[model samples]
Target: MKSTSRQLALSLAAVTLLSAAPGAQAPASSRTRTHVQTLASDKFEGRLTGSSGEKLAADYLIAELKRMGAKPLPGQADFRMPFAFTAGSKDGGTTLKTMTANGMERTHEPGTAMALSFSDSAEVSGPVVFAGYGLVVPESQNFGYDSYAGLDVKDKVVVVLRYFPEDADQKTRAILARYADLRYKAQAARQRGARGMIVITGPRSPNAGELVPMSFDTAIAGSGVVAVSVKGGAWLIEGNGRSLDEVQKELDSGNPHVAGFAVPGVTATINAKVIRQQQTGHNVVAYLPASGSVSGVSKPWVAVGAHYDHLGRGTTGGSLAGKDEVNQIHHGADDNASGTATVLAIADALARQPRKRHLLIAFWSGEELGLLGSAAFVSTPPVALDQLSAYLNFDMVGRVSDNKLTVQATGTSAMWPKLLEQANVAAGFDLVLQEDPYQPTDVGSFNTASVACLTFFTGAHQEYHKPSDTADKINYEDLDRVGTFAAAIAKRLLDGDQVPQFTKVEQKTETGGRAGLRLFTGTIPDYASDVKGLLLGGVIGGGPAEQAGLAKGDVIVEIAGQSITNIYDYTYALELLKIGQPAKVVYLRGGQKQETTLTPAARK
Candidate 1:
């Protein structure tokens, strides 16, 4: 009797599988594992955007969508949508030469003296001046430390120490550390009319005498001033009868009285060359039409997307790899390949179901480079932005520990909670629903466009953004379950009689790891823009930017009397602003300069 009961259960399961839709009948785990393994394989080269590896991944995704009978979006010739971006930056060639008053001369090569990634490509010859740990603390802090006090650096090369004072007290160190960034120091030198700047790691600081590494920089333009870091520059200051060690010790005391001096008879010439590589990345977009269409009434669309790009060889930055794993391929299995696989699975399942709304499926690239692909899609969308009912994104959904799944951007629509609850009745997931839509993913792109959005994510893990995040570590069973759960949600969106309404949720301002930024302007920068000044993607509702009459497509040129050339400059200028204090903001809109007063609010 027991054997008969087991056989009966098995037969019922087989019948249930056979009765389901053709796409849904396939083994979910097998399909998900195959997709992840192939996409994260060694030959894919970690799918770095604009690289050969990314092209290969695109081809694979296109072929998979074709196999599922998905068609290109309306008005598109093919599934490939290309967008240009700065892939990375590198030193083309750098040369440094110095001549002393004693008729001694020396020339340094690129490796011995490295140009910073943000350095401008220029050749300048100027007399050298030593500026002690070049830092300009904001006046609001009242720390009263200025490295350029009473020093004239116009048309001269300013030599400054890297990092802040090593021996300062904890409170003082914290305050100084906020303004000690190398870019801020270079900005100070440029503001003082310095032609060039040289940096040296002081003897008291860690990694003394080591040249700064040329990390990857995404900015197409330079930092407006030529800058380089040297392994040693003791000879520049030795003419004053003081060794570099003695000067460093004095500066390490963090006293306010230490003054810098000119290096007598030392003239240096610097030539810096930084090459910003621009490449075109492809976003795979396909459409699954509704089962039936009514004449003269276009059906609203719903989108499901996931980014297919990741760090390559851990070289283009965003690598959390340790010393041992340096330069290794960041497989990015759980980081985003898992999300890509889930999207594919969801697409496959939805293709066979009858739908009232058109399903737009996309595989985005350049997400690791600040959601470039998704932003481009929204900026120049193939369809009307107002026609999009909702967007669902999947990222880092491979590892579902303790059956917990986090669904974010629930506040974007009032209907999300009920829809998600209905979908999870079968999934039985321990759901963690968050209301904020300002996430650091593709969902934010949709949110800014006034589209209702949802993103599914598993909790973060130790292997995130590292080479150790390989395909073998993925929880394939849970990944398949996530796909099923998301497919259910998408099904409801596609066939429901009413669409979800967009809701704007006011989020409390927080300094998202930006050092020393205490006030919130609620301005979202368009990172992909190569404009001379910071471009506004969109202003947060009810925030300072909106209240000041700033809107999307505005280019901020100056803030609080400081010039804003790029995002970095904007960040430095933002540090100078005080809470509840209104500052003059100069911006350009429609080729005309405009002025406004923005009163910054304290971060909560």
Candidate 2:
């Protein structure tokens, strides 16, 4: 009887697969080219922030929405919702003065001054106090010994290091990435009654100007901090206050000795100037409403989202294509245009049929700028968040390998596994379900809101974030397949009775997938891990070693007698061996002790 029930379930699922809407009969060539070419077109200007390219992309999305017979969101006549911002250069306005033992003074570039987003040009003068790194990380405990103990930066020029405390490693880099910023530090100092921020370079980097600006893509948006790059030599003034030699000597010796300017006794006369401006950018949004209501359900909304922003012409400098000016467009064909196109395609399909739930389709901006648009949408939703049943996000859905696709969902939602499994079994596609897809993408914001969400991705390729991420590089057939798969899932979500379950264990960070090995694997390795080495950012199940008695911090050092340098080595070595193979694998259990492994087998 049990076997009969299992067979019946399979048969029923198979029959349901046949009921899935067949892809509309459109000209294959036309559909293929239109989706790929339109997005990759140069008119979009690589869809950079506050640029004409992005506006062009917006116009196209609006038109596409209109063509699909989609209506404007409530409370608006048009689909566009405008927002404002300020962007510009700060220069020719700041000056610093140091009192010297003698009566000499030095002047520096006006551009080497900082300005806050909300700040108007102001001049300030104060005694300089050296704050080592100026970081207050509670996690690392690297704060200098009583560095800021009772010290007030209020109305004073606070000099701090560029990166962090004396050491440089992954933890320190991550710390700096999360906390270190001259603008925020200055603001904190200002709030504490400090006048100005003077960031001194460390011995590792004597020149302050050596700190180049990371592209806007890398930083979290809306963190109010103004930073200026200055050179060590430029901070020198023989008689004004301090000498270059004195500052360098103190920096090298790690002593807080330099108090007054060199040749102190002379009051330093300082003049500073700064300039600022506000800039405006726009986000593109489009939605298609569902056709009919469910038999019992009242309000239902299934949203599909994707961000159309790219790294924007590489770092502050131009890319290798001789487009060195930051103004050159960073055509992000695969990064998201692929996802955007898939969303558009899904909109087209749903427009042909109505479901119980209304569909909200959106093409977001500021995703690259830290999921700003999606975050804003969630906070001030066009529709109520509770009404939103599920969000299916398509990001990087255009590429596939060996006909394999990765579908990521925050496992906190119970509906995800069931829906994903049904869709995969129905479609008969080789689908890899990943529980933690919320990583640096728009879907992450929705997941954080406890909204049931799923991200369809083809995994990262070599061209990720590079200029090479052009339209010509997309795999359209695979994209079409992904789009079809997502559409099917969306249809099911609209019909299914399951409400999103907000599980308590929302994975805050990616834990790597289990490779069912005896060795430890801490970080979740990227899909491209094999080619460019594994980035310990993702894992499938608990890493092999962890399930086999390893911990989160353990690093795999050896597998099957082969040295493991990265995730690739571990995976490669795993492939060479077989299931149930008895092997000795070694790894660092934590940072202190090393441990050995035994046999490997299938996980579960």
Poorly placed runs, candidate 1 (over 4 Å) = 1-25, 43-45, 96-113, 125-127, 166-174, 201-210, 219-221, 235-246, 264-269, 291-295, 321-329, 401-403, 425-430, 466-478, 511-516
Show where candidate 2 strays beyond 4 Å: 1-25, 84-89, 95-122, 127-194, 199-243, 246-263, 266-277, 293-296, 316-329, 508-604
Q: What is candidate 1's lDDT per residue for 1-604, written digit by digit as tens? A: 1243354345435534643555345576766876787677777778898889999889988877887789999999999999999866777778889989987898889887878877888999899999999988877777799999999999999999999888888988888887787889999998898999999998889999898887656655567879998888787777889999999899888986788889999999999887777889999999998888833334379899999999888787789999998988888899799999999999989987788888999999999988999999999999888888899999999999999999999999999999999999999999999998888899988998889999999989999999889888999998999999999999988887778999997766632326446788988788788888888988888888889999989999999998888777888888789889999999999999999999998876
Q: Report the alpha-carbon TM-score of model 1 versus the true structure.
A: 0.86
List TM-score per model, in order.
0.86, 0.65
lDDT of the structure predicted as candidate 2: 0.58
Q: Write the per-residue lDDT of candidate 2 for residues 196-252, one digit (tens) a residue.
A: 555656546534445323232221222222333345533432334555444444543
